[model samples]
Target: MTPDLIILADTIHTMDDPPLAGPEDSQHVQAVAISGGVIAAVGTRQDAGQWQEADTQVVDLGSATLTPGLVDGHIHPVFGLDLTIGADLSSASSLDEVLALLQAEGRHDDGWLRGWGLNPNAFGTVPLHRSVLDRVTGDQPAFIRLFDGHSALANSRALELAGIHGRLEFDQASEVVCDADGVPTGLLLEAAAMELVQRHIPQESFAQRKARLGELLRDFARSGLTGGHIMDHSEESADLFHALEAEGELPLRLRAAPWCMPGSDEESWKELARSIGTGGRRWSIEAIKLFVDGTVDNGTAWLYEPDVRGESTAPFWPRPEEYSAAVRYFASRGIPTATHAIGDAGVDHVLTALESLRHEVPADVLRRTVHRIEHIETVPDDLVARFQGSGVVASMQPTHCTHYSLADHTDNWSTRLGPERADRAWRCRDLRDAGVTLAIGSDWPIAPFEPLPIMADARLRRRSGKPDQHPIAPSQALTARQALEGYTSHAAKAAGLWDISGSITVGKRADFTAFELDPLTTSPDEFAASSVLGTFVDGQIQFMLERHA
Candidate 1:
């Protein structure tokens, strides 16, 4: 009767009920027994005694809390790995700091230097041109991405290397901003910026990429994450994931969604679908990703109104027809689609396409296909109701609300859509009230992929700082329990793996996260800094924080 593993704790936050519910109702027992990598029982200490025998390993997590392992519902793991090699300007708060960092790093002559996580807003204004960058970087080509990843700044030499000497061409929806003299500025918004950067960084070798992926996987495990949904993948990425699985090195559970090119032929998509099927013990392909538009920082997020500077609605990639066709094709094949749509207009276009497809496709086809609109940042009131009834999932990142200065955005939002529409930004509470399923994630490489930080933001509705800014509709803030669910059980459901993981019940995978401080009793700031004492996936200890005897 001895259990292979027994975990006992002072508190267990099942996240099974509302936060106000007393501990007894929300959780039970001091111990959880696991056998064959699945929860065998959840009951009192006395009950656990029945499962205990000579060989049983008792793990007494005294004074700590045990909860379901955190699942980062959305992220770009490949991109996360790439950051290790790229210039790390994420912590540079000001333009001067960024240049100083680059100067100290000393860029190579032929190598393309790239840095991510620079927020222009953090410095009060966008760094205007390559002149400042040129002064610091000398002749080396440098590309620095804004924290949001929607926009990027490139030095003159980098632009020249890409053959975009003084000016760059872009689609109607994209922009390559120029100075008053009509010369190309360092900044390029959305698709255009990505195009230039992509042309410069040559593809990394498979061996190098595999090593990077391994490092990232370990990092995720230490953060108490057991699974993640990779939003953007390529053929190379998919193959790498499979190779890792074969080698038993794919640390966390993976749901890879590769980018579906705009205007892809039917045969091509079908072939890609066949190549990437579902359910390996460690990896699966549950969705196809499409980029409908870009982020707000670069002023490229397709908005209902013009940008604050009086620019027209931002561009859409792949065009409406091509995007619609791709969605319909994926729908017909019974595969869910995740579209990156940040602005109101972008969300509207995606919904319109899905709505149109729903009518043409059979009822069964539509029901089987669960469409997701990523980053529903600015939704319309009417669309909120439609989204609720349409079975669309809102895969959102709450941390974005805190990271982007809402005060600056509020002024621009009100000017664009009037105060009435401004209330609809990241409506987590509204969507849940309307009976819509919410899946939360950290768009990593944009923000750190830690669930607690996101949970705190969702519950508090404000960041740790000076108040007086308009919080995103306080009524829309989720309770602590609801916020946890968004990142756990609900996130699993979004990725189509709810039944297999996400909960702490008998017959479920024994994946759990142990925290140094009980979240139930900890302060918001303490929760944000809480450490993961241990993480287990499929009853195997993936990470354990070193403790001194």
Candidate 2:
């Protein structure tokens, strides 16, 4: 039978092999043929040639590798794009540099200035307070987000606009850092606190957001991403994403989760659930997002003991039982829940809650409502054992450790957790060994959006080229194939789309990520430096780096 398209590559990792190196090594298949948006055959080049006909289009991927389309298990597309609108403080090395960046960006016509990706380590021994930000912004309302997305720094004007003066009540571990005099210092920890200033900041229009999202999707495709499981969904996002899907031919697939905060009323929960109707072939909204605790960098992670700074250690949901009830509330309705649980205490709370629901919900219901925990940053052996066959996914980002922390355990995150807990950083290998499903992601605009670098980091656990670059917890590093699975098969399982996507097998959707070199056998440095030659979705080329360039 004739095929619609044929691709010949040096290697093809079908992800269907029995725990082998790659498909080329296991099955000796060098070519794949597609028809009607599904894989028709996967065999040798000769086999593919035999299926060629008058209309068959053949693509020669010289020395390139073809694998299942990459999937970022967790990302924030709309929010990431929104962050790109202002000056990027990600590269600032010191507090003065951060102020210099804000001064360069200056005030906007709205009398507000915005910046994202501020690394807390830049402050060094200095405390992150409004006094520093006020130096540059003066009267302008300046709001900057830390690289971790768990905290923010707002100038005094922005704080006043948010009406935050002294202490406040919050369901989560959110806090407005106050001075010795009980006055806010312009530092907001966690979503609840950050939202105070975030809500007051000028928001982008729906049309502007749509345009930015379109650009972001194109960027995703170029980076070899064909699917992204978005963490949070805004009302504007729901409208724009559905509109994009309706327009047909999305560059990539999106499985979004509408946020479910801690303070919403029960009726509001139902309203939020009803708001997520259904999506088309390229998108879906079938999950809800929640945060159990904040991050360790800002001393918000719910650790069993206090951080080195002796800061408040509390769960995002003040009442543990209330959060447990909320999880079951949504799970009973057949909706999956993804919770952000970073510290060991936070991970324990989530696992205990899921265990409690084991008896209440039926087998099928529980399986359908597979819960996921994002960024299990620090977990003990006992808590890790709880996820074995528990149907909970460990959605992790390896770059978080590589980019944010150092091997010497002196990074802000490590110093906060202290030597003991910090040594447990991202247990990727342990989770996989315990039979827990692992789904990897970039958490973009926070780290990087590219999958290759993230995959390499997961495998190598250290930066490339610099011999002095130490490996942060090398014992936790994942194998190359295991890291690949984090972005392919396991990522699909994380989003509950394994049947239709994930693997490059016959009768499955023809979504593929093409690299200029065989990523499986390539050196970590080379793979990290490699470019994505092409990204195909449903047998159609959505992005070709050369053509676009």
Error of 2 at 137 (Å): 1.7
lDDT of 2 by residue, 1-549 (tens): 678999888788888735445444534778889999899988888887798899999987866789999999989998777666577988888888887888899877777888889999999988888988888887888888889887888988999899989988787668888999989999888877888888877777777778788888988999999989999887677678777777667899888888777776688788767856477678878789988888888887888888888963788887777788888888878788899999888999999888888788877888766689999999888888889978899999998998888999878988888888889999999999998889999888788889999999998787654457989889998988898999999998887777888998889999999998777788877888989999888898898767332
Alpha carbon lDDT at 91, candidate 1 = 72
Clashing pairs in 1: 173-315
Q: List candidate 2 segments past 4 Å from native.
A: 20-27, 246-248, 275-277, 547-549
Instruction: Report the alpha-carbon TM-score of model 2 versus the true structure.
Output: 0.95
Name the 10 consecutive residues with the lowest summed lDDT in model 2: 17-26
TM-scores for every predicted model: 0.90, 0.95
The local distance difference test score of each candidate is 0.75, 0.85
Task: Name model 1 segments beyond 4 Å from true.
Answer: 17-24, 83-85, 122-127, 166-173, 180-182, 191-193, 202-205, 278-280, 408-423, 464-473
List CA RMSD, all candidates. 3.2, 2.2
